[model samples]
Target chain A: DAGVTQSPTHLIKTRGQQVTLRCSPISGHKSVSWYQQVLGQGPQFIFQYYEKEERGRGNFPDRFSARQFPNYSSELNVNALLLGDSALYLCASSLSTGEGYTFGSGTRLTVV
Target chain B: ELKVEQNPLFLSMQEGKNYTIYCNYSTTSDRLYWYRQDPGKSLESLFVLLSNGAVKQEGRLMASLDTKARLSTLHITAAVHDLSATYFCAVSWATSYGKLTFGQGTILTVHP
Candidate 1:
């Protein structure tokens, strides 16, 4: 069975630009969450969605937003990207809340 | 809010050695997860501890959770080069179900 999938694998953007990263959860999964991992650090939670509704948000700023679709897929959007936004954005999927999760390979965003 | 921390942020061990990584959380969540990530890859779930005294093992790795003490541990036996990676322990958010607070990660390097 295919695990969580994300694309594009890597991305590059200029400062003050906008970028969108996409994630397709595993079949039968209904919860999706986003995380940002900077170099030399562990991932920090961003947002979580269940059944197409926003459920939880992390300490990220208003420039970061995400939404889940009916199919349980999710999209993470970052507006006015800054050099500090360059990191691996990971998407994780689970059958429900407080369940085991599977993560995608993640989208590596580098802002110049 | 929950705070998760892992000790000894980095480890280097020779093959055939044994080591243990500790994870501590500030809150009273009963679930914890372990993950491994390569240099440029997303996280791979290693173990999930659901309750106090829960223990799970795979290959040369074992994980246990102690809810009373609010701690989890990952133990490695007979480590090999393939075991080199960053390991993270994450605690489940009680209210958000799928939301997780991750530890700082322990980078393990096993050499022959």
Candidate 2:
């Protein structure tokens, strides 16, 4: 079986630019979440979607948003990015709400 | 707010040494996860501890969780260079779906 997969393995953007990172959850998984991992720090929760509905959100600003599709795929969008937004954006999926997660290879975003 | 803390953020040890990394969370959570991430890469699931006193092992690494104490530990036995990576512990609250609060990660380096 295939694990969670993400696209655009690497991206480079400038301040005030917007970027989107995509994720395809493992088959039969209905929950998708997004996280940001800055260098030297742990991954921080950003948003979660389950059954195509928003389930939870983290302490991130409004500029960070995400959505889930009917097929259980997800996309994370960051608007008006700043240099500090440069980080690895990870997408994780689980079979259910309280199950263990499988993460994708993540997209490394560089904001200049 | 749920908070996860990890001890010995950076560990340097010789091969064949034994070490343990602790993860403590501030809230009650039934599901805990251990993940490994190499530099510039995404996370790899190592263990999923579902309840108190639960233990799971893969290769030379073992993970246990104590729900009553909201604590988990990842023990490395006879560490090898290939086992060197950043380990993170994550927890999910009962109400959240696919949302995980992660610790600051423990970076392990094994030398000969």
Candidate 3:
């Protein structure tokens, strides 16, 4: 079975610009979560959606937002991008809230 | 706030050596996860430790969790060049749904 998949393997944006990264969870998965991984660091949680409802949010600023579709696909939106926003955006999916997660290939965003 | 910390942020070891990566969390969690990520790639799930004293292994990699101590460890046995990558540990509290706090990754370089 195909694992979680993300779109636009790479992206480039300028300061103050906005970008949206998309993810499609594995088949039959009901939970999706987003994470940001900067160079030389671990991924930081951004948001999580389960059953089309917002379940948790991370320490990210309001400029970052996300939503899940009825089919369990997800989108992570970042506004007013800063150079610091350049990182690999990862999407993970799982069977349920407390289960092990499967991650996507991630979209590498480069903010100029 | 929940936090996960990893030790030996970077490790370079000779092939066939054994090493352990440690992960500690600030609060009790129901599940701990170990993931491997190659440079410029997405994450691959390695092990999922679900309860206190839980231990799981795959090939030459093994992971164990100590919930009471809020600690987890990923042990590499006879490391190989193919194991060169970054290892991350994440934790999710019982009430959390798809929200994971990740430790700063430990970059492992296995030299042949």
Best by TM-score: 1
Model 2 off-target regions past 4 Å?
A: none
Q: List, residue by residue over B16-98, the lDDT tens digit for candidate 2.
A: 99999999999888789999999999999999888789999998999999888888999999999999999999888777757
Query: For each candidate, what's the DockQ?
Result: 0.89, 0.88, 0.90
Which of candidates 1 and 3 is the stronger one according to DockQ?
3
lDDT of each: 0.93, 0.92, 0.92
* lDDT (tens digit, per residue) of candidate 3 on A3-74: 888999999999999999999999999999999999988888899999999999988999999999888899
Q: Which pairs, if any, clash in model 2? A: none
How well does candidate 3 score on lDDT at residue A111?
96
lDDT of 1 by residue, B1-112 (tens): 5689998899999999999999999988857999999999999999988888999999999999999999899999999999999999999857668788899999999999
Models 1 onward score TM values of: 0.98, 0.97, 0.96
Write the residue-wise lDDT of candidate 2 on A1-112 in tens digits.
9989999999999999999999999999999989999999999989988899988899999999888988889999999999999999999998887888889999999999
Quote the lDDT for A78 in model 3: 96
Give the residue spans of candidate 1 off by over 4 A. none
Residue B65 shift from truth in candidate 1, angstroms: 0.8
Q: Judged by lDDT relative to the true structure, which candidate is superior, 1 or 3?
A: 1
